[model samples]
Target: MVSKHTLLSNDLFGDLNPKDWPISLADLPPGSALVGGSVRDGLLNKLSQKPDLDFVIPIEAIKFSKNLSKRINATFIKLDKKRDIARLVINGWTLDFARQVGKNLEDDLLRRDFRINAIALKLSKKPEIFDPIGGMDDLKNKKIVAISEKNLIDDPLRILRGFRLMCELDFELEKKTQIFLKNNVDKLSNVAPERIKMEILKIAHSNWNSSVWPTYLELQLLKKWNEDKLPNLELKRKDIFSTKPIAGVFLAKLICLLSDEGLSSLKFSKNEIKRCKNLRFWVRKINNLGLDNFSEDERFQLHVDLEEDLPSLILFLNDKYANVWLKRWEDPSDPLFHPSSPLSGHSLQKALEIRSGPFLGELMRHLSKEKAYRRFFTNHEALEVARKWTLENSPFL
Candidate 1:
């Protein structure tokens, strides 16, 4: 039986219902409670952007997690079996499960990494707010303070996590917390590379205009994390974070700005590394060619290479490069820059008597380049142009 505590109203938490949650009142383990993010976000009025919900139960966390995962038809992933931490993921739903580290809510909250993340509400019909570490007050103050020094020592990942939270919530880290973060920066090296990569990517993908690099630099975390790949703090550009959340191209740009070797150490995916390398290649090519020297075909190829990334790339470059891109596309509807190709593979095959194979693909690329360079206006004209080009280029013709 659950009691309805009006103060801990489920209504305030937009998506935090028993049906939507990992476990319902009937299935909730004894002494299980809704803790951390879900409760904090509800009070903070960040219902929409909250990522995942957290729950703590006294023992049986893994068994309960597996059972709840079965109930919700979610994927049960054991985060730390020894520590009794598990995760359930199903579509948009994510719930983290952990056993209470101490005897009660106070002890659990005290053992948490930060005060702003320690508040909780019991899992009952009659729920009540249980905040023992002044988390509510710290949250209201927009302050991020560690629960205790031992907490940071216990998990060095919290140092990185604290900076991430500061960026996410735009909060100020307490002075003592800052000292502790700086001192234990070395422990971050002991953290799993994948864990470190995830945090870095989160910082990139966030709407936080502020750079975590600054925080990392302050704590020497950046130097420690960099090892040798990002040797120069001045050159390891951190301005890639912006009001615009990091999407594909932006993320690639960030990776390029940060050294390839640094990303390798952090264990970014092969695809991510490849994209970043391509982006760097494009940047170098653009610099070497200059705005005026780049032919229309060359510029078009650059745009195609950087797909869905023109505006961002244009903005990120120096004044000269940015101006060149702006000048190139001043007429947004310019025929030379139009995405539609005037010729098709089938059209070329029929007109040029070319078989549908490697030759056809080559013609398509050729015609597409001509289209960007404004060599032909219509499909018929493009076919004629292709016919001439094939006669000149083909050995047997």
Candidate 2:
């Protein structure tokens, strides 16, 4: 609601400092302007150490991107030829250039998904902030406001992206924007699976809270994709963030929310799908039959199966067991936690004169389990146990 337009250049230039960019802005075209996240971040003064930059130009973006890559010695990639979108990678910074979507910069900015993301800075000797949509006002108020409902409907991935921004910036979604998102949640299926998967992980990696969980549930975001009902657990915990290999935390939380069918529909890798499936299987088993009821062999097999991914399961345990298991999992020398056979498969095969087959595989597993549970400590004992087991159970004999 301002009656007339005003030019505000107070601190934006100093905050952004185009002269400090890895690639000088002097090389860009006359009308080239820095837009999107870089502008939004500059306005917030929360720029990353190496911020990604996006630009909109009046003319050929792909050609300009390639020329810039050659000049700056960057890696060039054409993201979309039809749309005249391209990317340049150099010095840990990524720069994307795209053709203007409409007649002018204001039109292009108006076409963006959110007010916070629509602010643009015209790059020049005397740069000025462009706030055709009162985006700066929205940023000041710390709220997410969609440009229009049609924008969200045009690209439903923006629906999830808005929540990710909400988490990253600790901003509240404007009530109307939330309603627009809720209405368009079903259209998310029309978007590409990889794009959806990428946004899902970005949300997982953000600092989410209980409040955001209910919003996601209300939207029924993952309900259609999952084979079963979503996990009802509140995954917020202190140790989850403190644990090493934090990627496992993200993956574990994702699998808890999604099912194998959901993950497959999103085209997750075979290994990831398998790991999540096995983790779900064991989690169900452990929940059904109490952990206290597991036999020694069953416990040994759990460690064996999840030795690499045990960190992912530790959060599911109670405090006492979680602390104990985490301590053991961190210690490489903890025999039961990090199980290994005292004798190698080769040694067992040679000593027992057994060919490499199912029997030999079974012998190695048995020896490894026996060693894991403190049943044997040395190769001599392993050989003795192997000989006795072969005599008693070997099909070849």
Candidate 3:
């Protein structure tokens, strides 16, 4: 077994063996070196199953990547023409190639977001790890330390990315780095919405999000996207940890924190924004009018509206209510939680001689509520209720 000291001293990270690479690195330019997240994760011994490999080449990144793609049968995409950044995708691995940023490797590494991501490993038969910024020590200490505040300011999206790394690695931001991020948090307003949204989603989906999310809110990193200064949200770990971690619940909590305007400005999809609105509306209603005080219609509507996103609301409920709601929701047959009508619109229209219109739509909703509350059991009973409703509402007919 190789010791940690040996792994570092020999510059041979086990998880990054060339044999495991999706395609050969042999054809890369002579000065090509693997850099960024893959190197950092490799040293931490936490490389993901499908690691993203980034390479810095001394020259002709786009041309080299296009040629490499044809040779290896990988899909090549030119990311930036002027900067000569390109990507080659093969199997599940994504390999990014970029023209080295400055005159040499150390200069290129220095411009990266954080020390941990600044380290590079030469793509040679005998790989050499370069740690010009003391990134190895930062990794050993499990800290996210920015190489320089100026580097983060150049690309302000990296400010949020630091917290994302914290969520992914369960690492602490060094005190000075936290201050640096806080000072430059407002600069995120200058970042492209797509980039900001991408980093936010990554932070939300991390397994350790519950650990770092509170800190993220406290720092108000995305305040410009909010309607006002973001509140210091209380994210109780128990609220999330009580049940199995769910990506939907995490995303829901994150988006719901944003204003409708904020969500739109950040380019959240229409469906995503709609869901956030629904969640926000219900969360306010439930908070103002206690759940126990909900009319049967309101309660049924809540389940109907949130059938797909019930777990998102769990973050706001106390333990007992969360568990009770979750238990019922877990059962697919729970009519009150899942809320389906015993009879279809077609079946009702056929049985009741009701035309397809606004009236029919309302009747279907009424029947669904009755079914959800167990007021009617069978299709025949549902039909009977529908007939009574039509007679009472449209006696002339």
Candidate 4:
């Protein structure tokens, strides 16, 4: 009987020479079989451990498979005593193979989604690029084309994934694919909202935000999804790449645009809607401040008021004013941009000897605003004011 260690070592060193070992085999888990045999001998044994195993390659070893172990930092070990079976971990995913039907790497590339992602760079002897589906040509053309028409139908989420690819790679959707997308926009509703939100956020953060909306409009996806809810969201060509085109604003404008179409549909959660609403309110506030006459205190207050919304606010303000406002805020002499607040609820409680309750919380909030505005300098002053307000309003005090 062949020992498990001998079988594993032979498979591990089978295709790969000792000189080309990318990772030390000693790092692998002890007592673990690198590759296992197929069902004919004992398929149930393999299936029982399927959860721990990664991928299984058939008999035809594709070109991409040659260096798969090196690329993924896996140890290629064989399991079947009767055949040349092997298994390896690639990028933490277990890749296995039965000595039955292994095709070359070109076959694997052909099975992927877009042509752009199908191109793989080899790392072994006579290293050459392998593009099975004109992926390099598509990349050169700056186009996003699917590997096959059936790929999209098999997974409708690919429609949104295509949109995300446009944002990430700054590529254009092929006209035929665009048409198909428009025709099948309703299929997106079948996908989960969380997934849709993820893709939309990716687009909103991309440099192609402005271009993305028009595509959304042209494809009638906005209408189908009932995204028109915000007001006066005119998507000019310039807005696509604007720095202020964040996810919140994009969603707000899309909702507003959809609302205008008499649809009033929203794809975000309640918290997300609230965040967008807050962003819109603050963006308007910052915009109306008019950078020319913006005071240091006002800018500082704006920063404090916006808090987490500051970056997006600045982006929005900059987009509207064309860096005029951002430049103004960047000036060292600008007073509106203040330092961080020195007060906190805990500090207030300790300083005032107050218990954990709404009274102290309210007092702290009032003091924070006063401190932010530079109305009070010392804790004593803040406490005095809080005492006066508490005494005037409450008999308990």
Candidate 5:
């Protein structure tokens, strides 16, 4: 089998000098020889006949191929094509590109959004590191610096991306970058809620949950949203610099803290609002229970109640007391607080031998409640009780 890297080299560089192709392009998959075209042919002739030719020239292809090159060592082979493009595939990365375009890797690196991501490695011609944006310095300093100011302005989503990086990379925002973020926090409002929600979820799921609230506050981004109705939401810049807290727990707490504000300002979808509301409810429930009265069953129930709201629950309950409950609740071996209903409407319908209707639904609910409260050992026992109750109470039965 041809080595994946060798194939990629042939695909990207072919007979061309390795120095000319961008370092990032070294990883693309090999392209098939285009028997018809010449290197001197115009871009239209090369591209018009083969759409893949254009794709090979794009930065996306280089990035994609480079990632592929890392996985497999493919051989590079020269092709006698009219255009300076070649094709090869290695571990799923393939592209056809002009050798000349490959040489100017610096221009390609500059197009990236952040300095950190702009760093690239050349695989061929005495492999070397390329950093057109000084990303290495930023990385060393633990900084989340943008590639260009305009990069953030052109796409407001970068603001959230920056926040995400801060959380993921454990990097601090540069002072100037922070000021720029504060000035443009409003631009986030223009971004789609789905995009914003994705970033928020990522942060909430990360170890940087605590950082998120404070960072948003510093930018006054949280205040700009109609979260004024949430209690204890005082925005203090110092909060961001505080010790990092558990991500999930902080998220739940944040939602509860912002419950009154309604998720509308954040542009959360209906489903997202429901999830947030459930999270808030769980947080409030946990808070109300306090540390003293929490029982194994209660803790289990807390987990069940939270359901998908688990992340939020974790966020809200960060106190020492809450931590105790979390330890118990997080134990998968422990029985769930409230197991799913043992009795269903169908059970009621079958037990009653009655047509499916509201009556069966009502009976099922009553039976479920009894089973929950009484802690029936089995579904059969619950059904027996439901039968007796139905026989005595149902006019139709």
Candidate 6:
């Protein structure tokens, strides 16, 4: 179509060239079409680090994917047999093959969630685009529009996915699409928790000058599966703008949105659950430790206590507190101790002449606190404090 060719030369094609399409597209089976996200990304410069190429093969997908994998030396994976979908992974490049939806390609494209993700490129020596749903216009405008009103009804996951794309591609949801999402927000309960968690992570990890997450919450998308609601925004909402180093910072905001019951209900993995719990606990702990400023060493030790969760801890802090804590950690002039201790646990054990036990952990905690708050500048001074602690605190020992 003339309109399709016109879109090919637009700013969306800045990053990639259609001529640079993968070798797999060079050959094709009958009724095969290079459609959906891969086609959109090719035109729109939205290709991720590893390009994911999606294809529609109305024929036997498993047999074709396996053959294609062998031909290209890629890994063959069957995603959904009933749906007739398979995948070929080669050197970080994922080519997903799915059986055509409905009776034909036009029907398939129309059934997709968003028009922007519904375009296709015919498989031939000279591949021309097939834009049945006006996806090109949507891309040029940087707007996400559902191909049809039944988009959310067909797949509830798109509610979260729409917001994810908004964050990922720096696009806005079209008014009617937003309305559709709001009306069907509760439909997300039908989607899997694992799928929901991944979408949540994508939103949390999105690096954007302005955020759509608050809007996502406003639409009640989170409560579809999660009965618990994000806390009222009436409380001092942290300013997202003017904030730096905000990667995964949304998890801290996420903590504010959840209670213990709400968190437990999402069915996060054991480790993920622990990390989130640690985030919640430390936020409260630091808040309670307010006004009485921790000494440089004390702050460093507090950061050390938080261990792997230091980023989220920094996120929990107010701007002033974050700046102070970051300065203590980063500024060379600041006197915060090295995170890697000069004295090992073995050295501490030797100084205290203690064997392995629960008390060793307690002793380490006390020594770390003393070395921090008590202004012990050397390991020897720390040992002296340890001796005094043993005499006074370990009376039962």
Please name the candidate that would achieve the greatest lDDT relative to the true structure: 3
Q: Rank the candidates by lDDT, best first.
A: 3, 2, 1, 6, 5, 4
Quick one: RMSD of model 5? 11.9
Residue 88 C-alpha lDDT in model 6: 81
Cα-based lDDT for every prediction: 0.70, 0.81, 0.81, 0.52, 0.53, 0.68
Better of 3 and 4 by lDDT: 3
* Residue-by-residue lDDT tens digits, candidate 2, 197-310: 888777766666556767777766676677665345445553355445454655556776578998899988999888887777777777788789999988988898787778
Q: Mind giving the per-residue lDDT tens digits that candidate 1 earns over 361-386?
A: 77777777777767777777887888
Clashes of each: 5, 0, 0, 36, 40, 0
Indicate whether candidate 2 or candidate 4 has the larger lDDT.
Answer: 2
Indicate the TM-score of model 2.
0.86
lDDT of 3 by residue, 11-97 (tens): 555677667887766677788898998888887887788889899999899998899999889999999898889999999889999
Which 10-residue window in model 3 sums to the lowest lDDT? 228-237
Q: Write the per-residue lDDT of candidate 5 for residues 294-319, one digit (tens) a residue.
A: 77556545555564445345434345
Q: Which of candidates 2 and 3 is the stronger one according to lDDT? A: 3
- Give all TM-scores, in the order shown: 0.80, 0.86, 0.91, 0.57, 0.59, 0.82
Cα shift from native, residue 382, model 1 (Å): 1.2
**In model 1, where is the ten-residue run with the lowest total lDDT?**
228-237
Report the Cα RMSD per candidate.
4.8, 3.9, 2.6, 12.3, 11.9, 4.1
Q: What order do candidates take by TM-score, descending?
A: 3, 2, 6, 1, 5, 4
Regions more than 4 Å wrong, model 3: 1-13, 208-211, 228-234, 237-243
For candidate 6, report its TM-score.
0.82
